[model samples]
Structures are given as structure tokens and as C-alpha cells.
Target: MKKISLILSLIFLSIGLLGCQQSGKEEELNKEISKSTQEITDKPTIIGEIVQIEGERFLVENKTEKLPDGRPDAVWFSTDEMESLKVGLIVSVWTNAIEDSYPQQANAKKIEINEY
Candidate 1:
């Protein structure tokens, strides 16, 4: 009958609309996941020697990278394992964020001592 056909059409339309909305949500979620993956993949690692230690913060010096002022590139980082670190030790530091400054500053998310 015509009434049955109308009801069926409405149901199909509703399902189609719901499916479209669901796909939109899935697309948004996929974009967010891709962005997060890119951030983690592109995260930088600073490899240098511990030049100075101040409280919970330490300065890492990379002699190969130089500044316009002709000094070695250095960055100050705050770490939870300062007690385990010492001067003259080469370290690899993974950071979540870095602040722009004369001597860059960052918080170490991970640190590894590299032995020669």
C-alpha cells in the first residue's frame, strides 16, 4: 500500500541521515588521531653534553650547532632525574615543548645517557 511505502521511505531517509552524521564524526576522529601521530613522530631529540646543572635544571651544550654569536648552541631543561645526571656526560633528551629564548628552555620528558 502507499502508506507502507511512505513509512519505509521515511525509515530509509532517517537511516541515511544517521549514517552521514556517523561518518562525519568518524572523519573528525581520524583527523585528530592523525594530528596526534604527527606530533609524536615529529618530536625532536636534543643530543648534547651536560654543561651545567642548577637545582632541577641543567644546561646541555651542542658544540656542533653554533649561534650567530659564535658560541655553542645550548638549551636549559628541567628534569626529574637531575640527581642522576652530571656534568660532562652526553645525554639525549626528548621534550614535549620548548620555549624560544637566547638559551632555549624545555622540560625533559625522557633522557638517556649516551656512552662513547
Candidate 2:
């Protein structure tokens, strides 16, 4: 009986941890939605000025976008994850749109820099 109780307790603990992780993911999803709705009202201002102009990958501070059409608010980019990035450039990004990675940063799958 004791052994059975121990096993049950461990299972419960694992389930609780998984629950917490799922909640975090939900929060991130909420943020993405809010950003998109806000964009229509707030307007992120994508003026193309976005400087730094590096090798394809670029950084943006006040970037607000939709997650995906017919879903929620803003779409999250996989490339947005990287810290070191500049502005004024083109790049391809891969997405891991799941519950683990929150705020949805980019992966930078491809990059195309401006001519210097």
C-alpha cells in the first residue's frame, strides 16, 4: 500500500508541474493577441526607418504584430529570440509556435543584408 501511495504522489507532482508550464504558455498567447488588437488602435509605425542595417537580421524595439490571421492578436516571430540584432534589413525566420517558448521570438532561418 505504501509503495502504491508513493507512486501516486509522484504522478501528482509531475502533473502539477506540467500544469504550471501550460499556464505560462497561455499567458504568452494572450500577450500575442493583445499586441495585434492594440496594433489596430495603437499602430506600431512600421516606417521602414528601422536602422542598424546589419547582415539580414535586424532588431526592433517597439515591434507589434499579429501572431497569425484568423487566430488572435499578433503573430509571434521565431527570429525575435536573438538578443544581438540590428534594424533595416531582410531575414527569414522559423517559428516554434508552441507553449514552451513564450513571447514568440524568431529563429533567423535566413538573412539578406542591404548593400553598403
Candidate 3:
């Protein structure tokens, strides 16, 4: 009975410590995100056109596609998220690349297409 009580107490103690550590890590992450948001919010944006469209993915090839400066050959994203992106359709996209996953996609957060 004493052994079982000791084991349960140790488990509870470990869980409590882990929970506290995770909460601290979460707060640290939130602070980092807030700092990053402030840095990017000051930058000017390129509101470019949708050059191509695919299933759940769209491309907004900026005119200066010559440089290796992180512009997409074809931007890709979800039509559900950016409702204006349909096949053979042109739309304006606001986005940035993940950097780690380069060339394959330039992920767009917002899209707007011209209506007739």
C-alpha cells in the first residue's frame, strides 16, 4: 500500500511540473509572436495579380520573377480560403513564402478578384 501511494505521488508531481513548464513555454512563444507581428505590420505590401489557378492552390507570379528573391513561379493556395480563386481566373493576392518551403508555393492569406 505504501509503494502504491509513493508511485501515485511521484506521477502527480511529474505531471504538475510538466504542466507548469508547458505553460511557461506557451507564454514565451506568445511573446515572440507579438514581437514579430509588430515588426511586419510596418512594412509596405505588394498587392500582385493571380497568374494561374489550381485545385486549392493559386499562383500570383509577380512581374519581377527573374530574381531568386522568394517570388513564386506560381503561387498556390486554397480556393476555400480565398473564395475568388477559380480556374483560369485572375486575382490579387497578399502573401509571403514560408522560406523553408521555397519555390513550391507562395502562400496567400488574402485574395481579391475583379468582378465584371
lDDT of 2 by residue, 1-116 (tens): 99999999999999999999999999999999875444221222221223343443343322344345432222233343345445544333323322333332443333333343
- Ten consecutive residues with minimal summed lDDT in candidate 2? 39-48
| Higher-scoring candidate on TM-score, 2 or 3 | 3
Candidate 3 vs. true structure, TM-score: 0.47
Worst 10 residues of 1 by lDDT: 35-44
lDDT of 1 by residue, 3-111 (tens): 9999999999999999999999999999888754444224446789999999999999987888888988888999788888999999888875678896899888788
- What lDDT, from 0 to 1, does candidate 1 have? 0.85
* Most lDDT-accurate candidate: 1
Clashes of each: 0, 15, 5
How does candidate 3 score on lDDT?
Answer: 0.58
- Number of backbone clashes in candidate 2: 15
Tell me which residue pairs clash in candidate 3.
Answer: 56-77, 57-77, 58-75, 58-77, 59-75
All candidates: TM-score: 0.61, 0.35, 0.47
Output the number of the TM-score-best candidate. 1
Alpha carbon lDDT of residue 5, candidate 2? 100
Ordered list by lDDT, greatest first: 1, 3, 2
- Model 1: clashing residue pairs? none
- Cα deviation in Å at residue 14, candidate 2? 0.7
